[model samples]
Target: MKKIFLVYSFLFSVFIFGQEKSGAKQFWENLQKQCGKSFEGTVTEGATNDTFRDKKLVMHVRNCDEKTIRIPFFVGDDKSRTWVLAYDNDRIQLKHDHRHEDGSEDKVTQYGGTTTNAGSATLQFFPADEETCDLIPNAAANVWWITLDETSFTYNLRRIGSDRLFTVKFDLTKTVGTPAAPWGWKD
Candidate 1:
């Protein structure tokens, strides 16, 4: 009877382990499912002393997967730019291929961010500035803090050592297949 009990325990352990593994996969999958949606909002003024004022901006997150996502953002008449964001194990990374409106890359940038357990997302800034910036090698900022529901995330940008804060929010409900407009605008 003892041997039988031990066998049952082992089987139960395997079942639990399998379930946990699949649970994690499902969580990531659900996050990816948030892609293909377009969020219309304004890029509020950030904590910059610069003259960049608050204006309307559009953000489109699409082609999401466990590995990568395509984020295209634009404000006003400025040309739309696409960012390829990838999840490298624990880090969310972006390698800029500065493509012009003609689809040719003008320049490239290398940057990425680590995910926190505290429900915040941060991306480190490269080509560091000389003033008011922290030396943590990695300056962390809140990606999205305010939200009315789980499908939405709002981010207020606060530069390190600076008094400026900008507000930006994303709504995940507009997710549809790639729209016809350049910046994920509707037909």
Candidate 2:
């Protein structure tokens, strides 16, 4: 009876821990599956400016590793933006790395936050962090989320106390050839 009880306990422990690890791992794997792929995206909502209007918006899952992924977003001919997602210390972080055409860092770069919860196997949220608040005071209330499913990936952002909202959706079923390297990245 004692041996049987110990075996049951071990199995239960594995089931519980395995579920938690798999949730994160699943999301990471879903993203990794898109590595080396480029997808066209559209501004689905709250695109309040001409920046994205009539532009060829593209997102490339450019680089990936065990702990990090780099996705560059191209708007028309501009290649100044990259989104860096990193997993560490049991948390996921999101940051925007912006650069100029000449490979110089933009002043409003590296602004984002970390996930506050074990979101899900398909979604994660990042609320504005202290650094983001300091860099863009008006964005202090921002929250960003990314969702991935079998068919598509979506990136959304909102500011809790304001009219700010932005959403971009990319189709996963189709991919385009990789574009040129991002502004600051060497080929």
Candidate 3:
């Protein structure tokens, strides 16, 4: 009876972990398809910042590895933001890397969240983690997400229990000129 119980437990745990890894792997692969490509985007919704709306936006899948992917997000000429996605076993973490003009880290750099569950291949949600809340108190209720489909890729943010919302949609059907390296880095 004891041997049977041990075998059952081991198999159950393996099954659960395998399920978790599956979704993350699929999502990672989907994003990897855009590696080495640059896409033009627009602020489809959000009224908090007029500057964002007026500027041209671009996203470049600059680097991708088995466990990490870095995407530089350009706003007109401001290349301060890079979205970092990292995978560990079956979960994915999303971090925002903000840098200064001199290749120095910004005050509010490296704020993001980790996945609590295996999200679908086309979409994943990242709620503000403890680090993000500590970095920006008002962002305690923030939730960021990305969605990739046949036609477009969208980066969205919503503040829970508030009216704050921002969404940017990138056209996947076409490619654009690659933007310069983000601040704090050289090509």
Candidate 4:
């Protein structure tokens, strides 16, 4: 009888927590459409000394499941960046996974934030969370946003009190060839 009770309790918790917010449903659904595809983009906005300028930018919607989606972003031959999106019943999380050539994690990896509200299906915003602030103090006021529409997907970042801004716009009207698996991507 005790075993039965424990099993039921575990299942109940899973059922309650393994769900995503109602308003986020459509946004997740829309993003899922890009799974198994790749897109080429350009550094549409940034500082004059931006390293991404004139470099080949690629994003692959490589792996995805019900709760998480991983999109690897490649700049030229550098494949050390990936964006992880975690979906939940109350909010969603956006994390950056940075790695080195030997598949080792970088010091500034796993830095991101969770949605503060039920964002729209076509757009969402994530403000730097506590973890991010501790990892990068100057990023305390940073806000990252992604906009997805029928023709384009743009990833943007802005420092709330500064002029730091970066934007990359990928053309969704066409697909591109997928590149090699990003660093630290376990098979």
Candidate 5:
């Protein structure tokens, strides 16, 4: 009876913790499915300025690996932005890597945060970290999130203390040809 009870307890523990890990793992895998693919997006909300108006917005899953995925975002002909997602320490981290045409890092780059909770298999949230606070004080209260479902992927950002909000959605059911490398990346 003792042996049977111990086995059952061990299995139960594995199921509980495994489910948590699988939730994140599944999300990563779902994203990996888009490797080497490109999709066009539109600013569905919070486009209060001309920055995103009447522009061709594209996101490319340029690089992918077990631990990291690099996605370059292109606005018209500008190739200065990339969104990097990394999995480490049992958490998913989101970072923005910005560069200039000369392949030089921007003054405001590599600012993001890690996942604070076990988000669902199709969604994850990343609140601004200390680095973001130091780099962009006004954006200290940012919360960025990405949601992936069967038909779409949405990238969103909101500042907790202000009315700042940005959201872009891509259609997953259709993919376009991959664009040229971002400003800082080599072919």
Candidate 6:
């Protein structure tokens, strides 16, 4: 009687939550085609005369499929490191692969990504044992927030674990480029 009702209620809640997650994923799917191509910009670290600036940070994003994305990043014409993004059920997952110039894996970094129903996605990088909740212990991590618009995109990053709150923002407007291929419908 009461036990059966409790089980049914739990099942209903699970189903509703699953649908809500699917809705969030669908939003990302809609932009799969347009997310490809290349973006180049400068990346700055630190401040003042000691500040390190890499103007050759090339960001190449490719739409592998409706469920996967690949971004290859290079610093100062180096071509051995890359950041990979692939769909993990309703969310996106990020992987950092460092390699020698000859293409051997030097190190591996694991990162996580999540996208909201709104046109915003976050990529978070941390140690595997670290906890990421806003409350409870408050572990620090490197975070990137990307907000998309029909004609432009905004990228912001925050580096945690420091006494100073270090933040950077890049505002870019879309330029002329070939149209993105249709997902699932085109080759």
Number of the predicted model whose lDDT against the real structure is largest: 4
Q: Name the better of 3 and 4 by lDDT.
A: 4
After TM-score superposition, the amount by which residue 152's alpha carbon in candidate 6 deviates from its true location, in angstroms, is: 4.5
- lDDT of model 5, residue 37: 91
- Arrange candidates by TM-score, descending: 2, 5, 3, 4, 1, 6
Give candidate 1's root-mean-square deviation (CA, Å).
6.5
* Highest TM-score against the true fold, candidate: 2
Question: Which regions in candidate 4 have their CA more than 4 angstroms from the true location?
Answer: 1-21
Candidate 1 local lDDT, 1-187, one digit each (tens): 9999999999998898754423223334555655667676645555455333445466666567668777666555554456555555544444332445655544333222333332222222222222212323333432322322355645444545656456666666554344344533333
Across 1-29, the per-residue lDDT of candidate 3 in tens digits comes to: 99999999999998887555477778899
lDDT of 1: 0.48
Candidates 4 and 6 compared: the better one by lDDT is 4
Lowest lDDT sum, 10 consecutive residues, model 4, at 18-27
Q: State the lDDT of candidate 4 residue by residue for 116-136, as single tens digits.
A: 987888888999999999999
- How do the residues 1-187 of candidate 5 rate in per-residue lDDT, one tens digit apiece? 9999999999999898755555667788889999999999999888577588578999999999989999999999999999999987667999999999999999999999899875778999999999999999988899999999888889999999787888999998999888999998899
lDDT of 6 at 164: 33
TM-scores of all candidate predictions against the true structure: 0.56, 0.92, 0.87, 0.87, 0.91, 0.54
- Mark the 10 consecutive residues where model 6 has the least summed lDDT: 178-187
Pairs of residues at least 3 apart in sequence or in different chains that clash in candidate 6: none
lDDT of each: 0.48, 0.91, 0.90, 0.92, 0.90, 0.46
- The local distance difference test score of model 4 is 0.92
List ranges where model 2 is wrong by over 4 Å: 2-13, 16-22
Candidate number that wins on lDDT, 3 or 6 = 3
What value does the lDDT take at residue 187 in candidate 1?
A: 37
